[model samples]
Target: HAVVDTTGAGDLYAAGVLFGLSRGAAPDHAARLGSIAAAEVISHLGARPRMDLVAVAKSILG
Candidate 1:
């Protein structure tokens, strides 16, 4: 795993998990959301990008 930065990935993943829980998603689903969000950050060369995660989740869950 190439680490360019460890600034906000953890925070963003937490946020994603929280968001999923707030939306009434199951724990497993929330964890998956967090994992996906974290993966997005790690796959790139920066922290979580300035994107709308709610929109992404809506699209994904739809």
Candidate 2:
């Protein structure tokens, strides 16, 4: 995603990382999750998730 702005990137990334860790993912895997979440956040204007993150994470992890 382009970095037009980096408003909530870190928070989203942290959310993803924590979500992954809660699911028992490895640290590396968790980082990947954070990347995914941050990507979602930075893709648009706000920090809001366009899609359901839990479902998205489940789909990706599964």
Q: After superposition, how far is residue 45 of candidate 2 from its true place, in Å?
A: 0.8
**Could you tell me how far off, in angstroms, the CA of residue 37 lies in candidate 1 after the best superposition?**
0.9
Error of 2 at 10 (Å): 0.2
Question: Per-prediction TM-score, please?
Answer: 0.72, 0.84
Task: Give me the runs in candidate 1 sitting further than 4 Å from their true place.
Answer: 1-3
Tens-place lDDT per residue, model 2, 1-62, is 47655689999999999999999888998899899888887888887878788887787778
* Model 1 poorest ten-residue lDDT run: 42-51
- The candidate that wins on TM-score is 2
**Candidate 1 TM-score, true structure as reference:** 0.72
